[model samples]
Target: MFKILVIDRCYFTRTGMESWLNQTDLFPASFLVAALHNLMLAKEHIVQWQPDLVIADLHGFKNEIHHIQQLASLFSVCGDGIKVLLLESGEDAQLSDYFTQFNIEETLLKTASLDTLAQSIDAIVLSRPTRTEPKPAVPLLTRQEEKVLTLWMEGRSNQSIATKLSINGKTVYTYKRNIRMKLGMDNRFTPFLSLPDAIN
Candidate 1:
């Protein structure tokens, strides 16, 4: 079962996102945090819930793009397997390049229809590479591992991952090390650099 955390500032928006996720029939469970104030609380929420991915609402906040990048970086460094799906308005479309630089995945327009939203989520969560030619087999990841890998790909820090996984920081490091070894990314620099591709 895949678990997701929905973060948004407005009550109505947060509820709407959660409803949409529940309606998708994909995720087994979801944790909702509306009007998130402190970054520490966001970290704590991840640790407590250990969600597979995060759907972050980037609207109506100061330094919205920067905050999203910070969260993305935190998830990447940590061993949490969380991917961020940004919810943006048309006005914010200009910030796409900024998000790309940070390796944040795709963005969802705030005004998008429910069907469009569902398709976007499905694309992100259930995509797989097609086998048209001979290529190295992608590692098959367990649901839990995928969650951790998603966050790792987002550039969360080790301590952040530890908190999200409710495990010791060292344990987070060990999981990452093991993941790298299993994926044949055991080299230090290689693991860090190829992590995004490995997880995705």
Candidate 2:
């Protein structure tokens, strides 16, 4: 079953997306949230959830390029098989440069109808290619850790993710540190952005 992570600060605003997903029969899996107060938390959350797909709202934090880069890094780690959909209310032309830099697969304007959004989700999930081989077991993550990584990819913060998982802040930090060490991101200032670029 496909797993989804939704990242946005205001849960109320995401009602349309949530409602649409619930009413759809196309997806056999489920979804969860990893909301964040700021960009830093978002990066931390991605390392925690490790979701199959990420749906992000880029409204309040439009200027935070690092968060976008972190999302890009998660996409890279998951390979092209995982899908990421960006939700925004901005000019298409202006997002081209940024989308290219991050390799974003698709974008849905905030003004789009619920039907369009549902259809877009259906298309992405249905078109996902099957993996040729079993994905290598990522040593750093337990099942819970992987769930956290999925949420992290959606750009939620430590505290926010912890709340979603019913864990504490300190435990979340421990997992973040472990993930950094496991991914060899301990030394980099902005490891998410730097590591993906280095590997490529």
Candidate 3:
């Protein structure tokens, strides 16, 4: 079953989106859901329930484009396989940076067709590629260091990893920095994802 979360401040607006999805039979597949008014209100639920998609409104935030990028990244940081579908007002239609930075699954105008929204949501949730192929070991990394590398590459935040590994967050950060250096990675983001692909 696919899990979905809706984050919208306006009660009627939230219900309307939910009703439209249900009326369209949007995701013929199963969907378990939860809806809340804001990110802060539902963040813990997100980590615990692990929703497959998050339908959110960017209009609620300040400097909305940048906020959207960070919001999308939060899913990754929390180790949730949550794809984001963002809604924007017409005044701030262009959000290319969000696409480049976090690569959100979809973005639509607040006034978009329900059919389009359904297709967008369905496409992302159903078309995900599974990590079935065996990945070769990184020759450059020690087994322990590789543990750190794997967790970071999977997008766990430092504090999350610290708790998981029972190490200090600073140690996780140092390990991350070292892993980047060993990988010849000059900047954050794309290189970490690319290096593993190349090795595989």
Candidate 4:
């Protein structure tokens, strides 16, 4: 499910956007939305919830330059995989820098049609490559990583593996992390298949 955060002081606009997106065919049952009024409060929510999309109205924040900059900084810091859609009363040249610097991709006038809003969202959300369940496949491990995994499975300590491999202990840990990522395993102890027969 995709999480959406709608930020606007105007209750009507905030909830209205939420309702329209919820009912629209673009998401239908896919969106989990949270609407808020304060930009400061929204910062806390953004850090905790990490919403996929944020639809915010800048009209209410036009007078608060610090708050606007703060909002932009918040996004710039932890905004990976997040899409922002800004709604403004008119084109504010001052905001162009914030938009470019922070990677805020979409900006629409407050009076824009819902269709236009939907199109912007469509381009942002639908164009992203959807993540699917990982399938079992032959893991492409480097020779060094395979050696580390072999020693790891034999219950060798990181220090022992490092000594045997003539590498630093931290390098052993790095190889293990890479191995787990390649296998899509969450923890060091998760059970996974052995190396393919071709490698044996």
Candidate 5:
């Protein structure tokens, strides 16, 4: 079974992608399309449901590269290991920092047809390579990072962690990015699924 998560604020975009997936001839039986309008809600599902691929609409991401870069980076990590497919306006297609910093699966221009999107999906999922061996274990986290990740897993929001630690919420997010990096997790990750083992 293939599970996909769609993140887009537009109702049409969300449904259209789902409809496309359903209608695609290349897609075999046993697929699920889960969607959320924004990243906040999607974050929980990405960690819990662990979708096979993620499709995000980056309509205005260029205006806020640093913040969006942080989001894209974390989203990339949260996919367990799968890269998020970014959809952007072709006008925003200029070479940019976002393109340079992140490992997006595929960048689809808005001009791209749903059929094109489906084909990209078919290509990525069907041709995905399998891992033959376990990756090296991720190194331990800094004590500060460990604290933040512990609270994050405990269902605390970034603001909550900031208050608890007397640090800025932005700093907390940086810690999250770092934690994701240190874990070096792949598609097989179940965030906090094995908290005791991960922390120790």
Candidate 6:
């Protein structure tokens, strides 16, 4: 089975891509697909899920070159190598240089025909490295940590989360730290797309 992650801020696009890829007869392999409408949480998902291929829409990151760089860095160091297919808008033409710099070779314009999209995916899949062994699963967040993260993702302040959870403020902070650590986001300043906010 091939694991594929679709990252696009558009709900329709994410679902549409997943559906199309699954329904098409272009590839005989089975696909285990996951969709995310947030770019910020992509690294976390990618690391934990260890997808064989990632289809990311770069339209949202046009003005955020640093965010693209960050993503490129993650792909560079991914333990088991993976392939990426980036979707970009017309305005993203200038960003091609960044792709070349990061060795990201497969990219397709968002307005490209479905046939072209399928071709790009086929090319990537054909070139992807075969995995010899399964990666060990990453640790999951504890229930309390998940609760704290849900609240924090809703724009709650640390104190607000503490009050909501009926826990001490310090405990809430600890939970937040643990959540971040488990998600492989050690950098406190790394931006995250609030799931609820980004989904819509």
Best model number under lDDT: 4
Clashes of each: 17, 17, 0, 0, 3, 0
- Which pairs clash inside model 4? none
Worst 10 residues of 3 by lDDT: 191-200
Of 1 and 6, the candidate ahead on TM-score is 6
lDDT of 2 at 172: 77
TM-score of 5: 0.55
Better of 5 and 6 by lDDT: 6
Whole-model lDDT, model 2: 0.59
| lDDT (10s digit) by residue, model 3, range 1-200 | 56667877667778877676665355666555566653433454566556677787756653422335556545554353667788755445444454446647777877888778778877877766433332322235555566776566555777777777889999987887776676456565434333332221
Candidate 6 residue-wise lDDT, 37-95, digit = tens: 54545667776778888888766655544456665655664444677778865555556
Name the candidate, 1 or 2, with the larger lDDT value. Answer: 2
- Ranking the candidates on TM-score from highest down gives 6, 4, 5, 3, 2, 1
Candidate 2 per-residue lDDT, tens place, 47-148, comes to 555555667775545665554454455455545645778877566454456566665667887788877877777677667643334333223446666666
What Cα-based lDDT does every candidate model obtain? 0.54, 0.59, 0.62, 0.69, 0.64, 0.68
Question: Which runs in model 5 stand beyond 4 Å of their true positions?
Answer: 24-26, 60-66, 93-95, 129-200
Give lDDT tens digits, candidate 5, residues 141-165.
6668767865776667778888889
lDDT, residue 46, candidate 1: 57
Tell me which of candidates 2 and 6 scores higher on lDDT.
6
User: Each prediction's TM-score against the native?
Assistant: 0.48, 0.52, 0.52, 0.58, 0.55, 0.66
Candidate 1 lDDT over 3-34, as tens digits, reads: 55666656677676666666536443332322
Candidate 2 global TM-score: 0.52
Q: Which should have the higher lDDT, number 3 or number 6?
A: 6
- What local lDDT score does residue 52 receive in model 4, on the 0 to 100 scale? 72
**After superposition, which runs of candidate 6 have C-alpha atoms over 4 Å from their true positions?**
24-26, 63-68, 78-80, 129-175, 185-200
Any runs in candidate 1 off by more than 4 Å, and if so which? 24-38, 63-80, 93-95, 128-200
Q: For model 3, what is the error of residue 127's alpha carbon versus the real structure, in angstroms, after optimal superposition?
A: 2.0
